[model samples]
Target: MLLLAECLNQQGKSTQAVPYLNQVRRRAGLANTTAASQAALTDVIAHERRVELAFENKRWLDLVRTGKAAEVMTAHGAKQKRKYSYILPQAYNITSNRLLFPIPQREITLNPQLTQNAGC
Candidate 1:
């Protein structure tokens, strides 16, 4: 369904992209979305991506696009702090330059226009 949604979003048809997304989830034995607005839909889609595409490289771009890159990754790989797991890895420091992911070394050297982010 993401294929359809991606196409629709690219074509500025994201609102109409709902049906296709619903269809895809149904095929995966998932229920239909209950989101009531675009923001909710975006949140739902992000959670879906995290679950359905876990272990894949989906989070980085999603984080970057939402500008929650730091917020999300800071607690990444850590289960919620509830009555469950208590320890969490410190992935990124949200208040500092550590939030800025480093540019690839190859890209930096290949293109002088590129600059390295603070923490590399």
Candidate 2:
């Protein structure tokens, strides 16, 4: 699951991730999603990543990269902080900045030439 998502991310194919992302759920016997239904492409991918790679705790960063961060944060993040609450965030509005990730601190330290991500 990680490999697939990483591959999608690395290849700049996150938008094309649903077919492969749903493949992750197929492992658990859920209905497999097709590119046609990837309508909620970003969310479906995020949810797929959530359980598909739950053991690795990859959803947080995945959400951020998919441009679903603020939507997830304000929606899911806020709910997560609520006591005993468990409301699912519908989905964040998608935009351009959703694709890139913040460079690692170590990498930035080693290369002053690198710039911090547009949004942190």
Give lDDT per model, in order: 0.67, 0.61
> Across residues 1-120, which tens digit of lDDT does each residue of candidate 2 receive?
645655664566765555566666777798866434334454465566676677786766676655666665666545555644454444433345555677898999999998888765
Among these predicted structures, which one has the highest lDDT?
1
TM-score for each model: 0.61, 0.48
Kindly report the root-mean-square deviation of model 1 from the true structure over all alpha carbons: 4.3
For model 2, what is the error of residue 38's alpha carbon versus the real structure, in angstroms, after optimal superposition? Answer: 4.3
Which residue pairs collide in model 2, if any? Answer: none
In model 1, the worst 10-residue window by lDDT is 77-86
lDDT of 1 at 107: 93
